[model samples]
Target chain A: MIVDTPLLIITDLVKEFNDGEISTTVLNGLSLSLDRGEFVALLGPSGSGKSTLLSILGTLMRPTSGRFEMLGFNLIGARDVDLTEFRNQHIGFVFQAHNLLPDFTALENVMFPAATRKGRETPVDRRRATELLDKVGLADRRDFPASKLSGGQKQRVAVARALMNSPDLVLADEPTGNLDRESARRVMDLLIDLNGTDGTTFLISTHDETIAGQCRREIRLLDGRLARERH
Target chain B: MTYSFKVALRYLASNRAQTALLIAGVAVGVYIFVFMSALIGGLAVLLLNRTVGNIAHVTIQAPDRDPVSLYGRDSGTLVAILKSVQQRTTLQSAAAFLPAIEAIPNVTSVAGVVAGNGFLTKGEAIAPVIVTGVEPDQVSAIANVAGNLVAGSGDLTIGIALIGSGLAKTMGLQVGQRVSIRSERNIDATLLIGGVFSLGVSSVDDGAIYVHLRTARVLFELPDGVSRLEVKLDDLRLAPEVARRIANTTGLKSIPWTEKNEQLLNGLVAQARSGDVIKGFALVTIVIGVASALLLSTYRRQSEIGIMRAMGATRRFVVGVFMIQGGLIGLAGGLLGAGLGYLSLLPFPLPEATSSTGLPIAIGEGAYGTAILLTFIGAIFAAIWPASAASRVDPVKVIGP
Candidate 1:
């Protein structure tokens, strides 16, 4: 059987931040690749550059030096506007803080990504958002504003929002960092079930070993470089 | 609804207090603007009507003559009397020219007047007066003297005269009083004062008297002649055109009242300029108030803006959100202010009637519309800077861990 092309490729990636004459390196000569439909966990402690790497993958930050390609586009060299469009069409992001707009209802928050990209919500998109909300087990709270939801419920809404556009790649950064053990397991189970059924690619960054153990593969980053890889 | 408008409305709805304050600020500004325009514009119209209503728009008179002095005080009172006789070089057959003058476009009414100097004597008081000869119905059509009759009627019959209120008071004269009226031509008659009038102009009130046209003809020894024609037009602004047409046809010296009173016209221009300056300052206040409010709102929603950008909203979309907020604020405030302004006028009483409709103040449609439009556009422009700032928000910087 022939193997399909990988969905992501990063080589010799580096990122630096400058404060006047001083510079701090965030990602130092990192390299990684992932195939389609793969569920990979990025494992690291604080200051290990996992979040920085996730930020770059989400198209929010540009690498200082790298060859980065996603879905065949050279992401590192794309213009700002083109990058925004590419991210809108192909990438979904779930933040640790569950950055749901407080002014919008849970349903509106879940529909936000698609609404922003499409400029309007169609019937199909609304139905998909409703189904996702049902899958997340928050159908009863769909009309509640995001600020009124509990921590776990908000994170679940963020998860539903990430899949709103049916993105090709989903990047989650400490998605369950603020949730309790039971809530964390439930979020992880939801992610695993979506991956298994839809074959959607996932790259989640987490410090929890139990969460890393659940993924199909694990990549460890230390001192801005990949330290270990396991499957 | 478009995405930007929906988002903007949601943001405004979430911050109810801030949105209300913004709307109130714009409403107050618009209200003041409308009120000021109405007050100043009404005042201007009232002043113009008061000055122009009682007088003829165009006065056609005989051409100028070389100035001549008949006597000094050393020449005795008889020489003085001769000097007082107004050089009555009447229009040659004034009746035949009336038809041509009235045929001029825009001329509504034309009345032939024989104006000469005379003296009103009652008991011991004697006052020099302008004795104006007029046909009762014809003069009433050109001037508002018929409306100003304070005592007696507007009847200008033979041997009966209409005297000014001020002249009547000074000479102890009243309606039906037998008064000695001696013209400068040395003709004397004891006439009854049929009416007493006040023209609202101090000079005209103190020194004018009206008599029948035939009676004046017999007194001044000018048979079928008039010194001038008082011309009224459909529109006062069209006086010059009508007067020019009349003068060209009748060989008379036609003068519009606007040209006759240069100082009054200059004062009106200055008043208008001052009103414009006040309006300009009011608009500036509105612009600044709107801009500052929007800037603060943008700053307060910085994180929300970043969230939207991360969700694939373009910079233009973000900018459009703030602009929509500005436009809606302007529209709401404009309507409220217009309503408030019109209502406020109801409680304040008006002065005496100066208009044909018996209204002291007049509302101008064009001025009201202009005030509302200027305020609306000003508010939109005021929001641009804040909208631009909102669009420039960086998602990576704001959302980074």
Candidate 2:
């Protein structure tokens, strides 16, 4: 039964990978939905298709078959250009490696998503980027090049960049995967804090129980299929 | 700057060695282009000037045929006999045509001469010669014969004549030596050799002599006829038009220098066409080099391109970024090439040369501007395919990998 009008809907999503003559199912009839401000974790072991589902959700890859909708807009059959625009305006991604564009400064990295949308940096953008850096406790390190920052700082900048465009959803694909224990804790704390304050939906794919435990909900995948959900 | 432009700058700045190499390649190409055009163009102009400097731009002479009477055949027969007996190749009273010709716009100078074949004798030896009657100042103004004079004054007096150095040497004569010259009509005169000159042409130097117009008329027994009139114009290129105008106005046949030097002009045109081919090849090499360099650059920046695409840069924006990079590189190279080419020409000044140094070249502003524009376009065109390839980078595959 439909309890409420959800911000996202996915009905029997399917994804498969082909290597020459043979094909393997990465996601099999998987279905999930999210509200406007939900902090959800996708938990799975290796080869469980958690990353594949996240890739499809982020519009980086096409699904084999399914109906996926976000804010009442059909996403499954959208054209490539429309998908790219949808991602730019509505979805932000934080990769495990931070993916901070090594050539840019921390502040520039934080402002990049917004600049990519606007095609230029304005004074208001600079102020917003500075405020985001300040919120992430990396104000003093804003001018530093991303390459020069510590692993923790880069992840923090990636988080700030993800929020720069004020996207409706932030997809974190094992964002703390490469970090040390302390850096991982800090990154998890940052994501939780942003989720709590900003009221933005989050879909974090992680195998780490400690990170998943911190989320409001955890959905586990088994053998390319959704096995259980816990809240 | 736009996002793409900033990204382009960042990419180029990060790849210093590649950028430097590309600029250097373009600079060298531009240098070659500028140097070749200047060298060949300068040599062409020099050859043209040397060939036509002392020659007439246009020459006016009497019509080769005599007019026939329309009324009677006997009248035509009498006119033909008179013309044959009178040696009608000469223009009767050609001096009257000078003022009319000189009045034409663009005509710098006009000079008439009476010329005929004769012989010079000393003691027992005799040499055949071509004698010319000229007003020294007027002929010098039109033909610039005074500039090539090897010795003595150009003044032609009644009893004095100027003989070519070869003729003077053959007759065992020097300045102030007396020589007997006889015309084809059996008229003879004994004149003193007042000057010796060398016109560089062996035919003229070996057998030509100059005398006063009155003396030549008396020697030829013509009283008042000239062989031909030579005209100089402000611009030699205007010779055909001036010749046409003179022919229309004076009822005289005018021959321009281009008609007289048809073979040489044809050779020069062929040389220029070959020069253009070489320039075209050089430009192609430069364009290919730039294209190859940009293609390598595109592959090297594939990851960055993927991230940019993932960040929501459109395919057109991605292509624009690489195009900007290519344009900037080409612009930098073209400007640098122009500077390099200009500097290379500074060491040698014009009008000084040897076999080793060859001739000094002149580079014009038009050549520099043209080279810059051509390379800019070539560089942009060279970048299109690579930029398109860069735009086609798959974000999911590239980013994940």
Candidate 3:
């Protein structure tokens, strides 16, 4: 499933934040591309625009000036509604804080994308969600509320949710940033296993060098631009 | 169910205490609305019943004749004048109009009456009185005279009559006693008092007497037609329309009870307006309470909303979740409040003979349907601000840096 064709392309992307008299440029002329089914890690220090890049790629933020094409369609100037649908169909996200709806069960959290997209939960969605939960080693905890889960378990559920829609690309921002060493290892293993079996591409932003070493490619950002790349 | 609705339910179920408190607040507001509606509605009914119970809903009488001057055609001078102050105006051919008057919709009963001024004389005392004559069987058709009788029976025979308690007291007259009645037309007769009644109206209780129509014609010297017609209606509110129809059909002067009781109608209207203001305030309070609480909830769940947005949930979806929550609260609160209002008023009995001054709350008039519909709609309106705010949450800012 590792195709030679590129899945996404970025050129001369720029992003700036303004507060009255102050203008802070988060991404300045940064550009990168990813091929289908590639596992890439984004490495950067604090305030190095790693998260900003992930946000733009996930279609959650608009770049001030850039050319962004994902799945052969231009995304830089797309309408918000169109972008929302494109993201739901083509992109997935796992936040650093494991932002699952605390009131819902693990299985419900995993089924959130499909249920919201279809307007209601169907039998197929339930089956897929149950399978995802079992794959994440939380089959017994499928009915447990998100608030009742431990931090690491919550992160694992977040990963399962990001994969529930079967999106082509998953943008994970420090997915295991708040977990202990053992929990972090287990989550990373799960991500790798899913990528190898399903052929889903992953672009993970992380400060942990050990996590970056496990990816097929590593990208480093410095002062809002690509500083280095290694394979 | 739709995911939006499911999510709204989950959110509410997660915060049980807050949800219950919000619903309770809405219920209290709805209860106030229902209470006001029932009280004001009940008071109006009570007033109308008391006022219209003892009088005709519509009265048809002969048109008044004003004096006119005879002018000479050749000169601008008044030649002669015609004026009569003592002439009695009687409805001519009253019997011919009874069928037409009774045919009007909502007309329950119609009675032809002969009324005239007279004097009641006992052996040692004399009192001025008004003598009303009607058919023996229809004595209570317009006024409930039979129901108010305190002694003897409401019998109107050729030589027997009914007198008010005030007139009976002043002359020391009792049932089975004879009294002399002298009419303004100079006709006189001695009749035995068959009954005594107290109608609660001071003027009527002091001087009114009832006699047979045959005897009244002879005493008042009305040999041709009855004096006037008294009309009763099933619904007193239809009096004006019924009176209009009667006047058109009978060629007589018709008067409705509402025109005669202007002050009472005005008081009832003012009371209703005040109740509306109170009900309006209650709804406003409910709207404010729901809006503020939902706004807080939106703020508290910012990160969750951000996650949903990042997961490709549309702004409309987010809005639907919040609005559904508001609608649910409104519907539940409305039902609870209406039930509570009804149950609370059940202990207070309606006004009756045993308790004439009972609590004036009409439980059946609580306006439950209106309360529920308004509250449900109001709650949805209240959630607009919060729903919009939640939909506008920035996914990047909350979920990322």
Candidate 4:
């Protein structure tokens, strides 16, 4: 109940959705806690608000009423500029679709978050990005466009991009949903491997139970509520 | 914004069809703007230069009859106004011409003079001619009027009249022969012809003969007053402004020849306005092109825009990116328009087209300044809506699943 000086802490978070005359509740008193270096898996059905919770965690939306804190910055009250800076300095995200810029090569796509936060490209940023690309085994495909990569390679590049700034927290919403079973396992292993090696905490939402078994901790959501936390 | 710009550039470059359409639109707008400015500027220059060529600014004409009433101008007031205007610091030089203007002011050398309308009879041939009276030594200052007397250069020594090739052919007159001209103003006096001046405009050479103004007036028995005032300005443009001042100052209305030929003035004015209207049409086409190009471009990338917002890009970033795209299109089009217009002018040689061979081609400085301004303004205007649409992309989630 008291502050644990946690890496991420959310209390009584509620996000409501309205479809014209009808209003639907997406999250109801969704409380969660994550400490440093914790790898979390969020398992839910298609309409269970797993992605919504991730969006809130990433500072992409304001909770209807609740408290959210990340790395000592107040999430619910952050300005656009401050939130952007905070995201730049702390949070990283990977998606189910890979979502790489088709025009830029894999290396350049990985650097998008860095450039978005800081509008210039210095030599040091390039060096750091190339290092992350190497970590995700995409060093050879650095100049290849995301479209040219295999599903596994594209998701690998996505992981590289998520770690571009070496942030303390990484969010992966279905990091392997679009991949073959073998590729799904490989990307899951890579994310778990990175959590151990870099000590970067990760929160992942996945439908695959095999992917969920790979994480150190699991939080399952049912109908927009935290139904179970497995240790 | 810089990152957004980079994205915009990539987006524009990747979509070749969209980029081409936008540039084409922007270029058209730029072209119209540049050409309109040049055409307006060109028309003004033509008036200013031509007015100064034959007439002097700030002439003193007798205030007796209002020039508007057609009561005829007073040559007596010509000297008084000249003296008065000459005293003012604003005026450069003042020349007082007699009602019959037997002299050129400031310069003592008077070229061949022209007295309009004469009946010529030489060697059993009779042709109507415009009789010009010119001083023997002052032929060079007449410019085109000097070239008109190409045939009998040496005739002025013994007072033999030079005949135009056209007049010579028509009248059946030859060199060293005397022809008789009955003055139209007098109809009774016979003036001895000295030479012919063949100006290039057909009416100028075929219709005219050269004689001394003194001799022509003597033959016509005209009073010493010049029927019309021909004033020169340092810059012909100053003539209009200075003319307004003179009209206001002396209460004497002086009609510039450019004004006197109302049909020509109106025609030229209409030509220029039509040029602007054509330019407007070109601009409208460009607007349509830019609008559609941007609309298509945004439509094609609606999903990408949604994805970008999901990537945490702000609405402002998306909007800024699109705006920059518009700015770039406008800038590129503007540059192209200016370049195309300038290139087009290269074929029109000012020396050949203008009466003044010495008329400096002034396309250098003003044109460049105009192109830069037009390109920037036009490009931004063309791209504005499309870029705003980009900004209006509410975090692709609204548009995307």
Q: lDDT (CA) for every model shown? A: 0.83, 0.82, 0.90, 0.67
The most accurate candidate by TM-score is 3
> What is the C-alpha lDDT profile of model 1 across A1-231, one tens digit per residue?
113888989999999989999999989999989888899999988898998888788888899998999888899888878888888888888888888899999999988888877787678888888899999999999999999999999999998988888888899988899999888889999999988887789999999898999998999989899999997
Clashes of each: 0, 0, 0, 36
Leading candidate by DockQ = 3
lDDT of candidate 4 over A72-171, digit per residue (tens): 7778988865665676568778888887777778888888777766665557878887888888887888889777899899889888888887888898
Is candidate 2 or 3 superior in TM-score?
3
Tens-digit lDDT string for candidate 1 (B195-310): 99887776778988888888788767778678888888887768778778878998888999889878877887897788788888878988898889989988888888887788
lDDT: worst 10-residue window of model 4 chain A = A80-89
- TM-score: model 4, chain A: 0.95
Model 1: lDDT equals 0.83
**How would you order the candidates by DockQ, starting with the best?**
3, 1, 2, 4
Interface RMSD of each: 1.4, 1.8, 1.1, 3.5
For A1-231, candidate 3 gives per-residue lDDT tens digits of 667678999999999988999999989999889998899999999999998899989999999898999999999889998999999988888888899989999999999999889999999999999999999999999999999999999999999999989999999999989999999999999999999999899999999999999999999999999999997
Which candidate should be chosen as best, given lDDT against the real structure?
3
lDDT of 2 by residue, B94-189 (tens): 878878998999998887877788989989989999988887666466545566667777777788888888987888888878999999878999
RMSD of each: 6.9, 5.0, 3.3, 7.7
**Docking band of candidate 2:** acceptable
Off by over 4 Å in 1: A1-3, B58-128, B178-191, B214-256, B351-367
Ranking by lDDT: 3, 1, 2, 4
For residue B153, model 1's alpha carbon misses the true position, in angstroms, by: 1.6
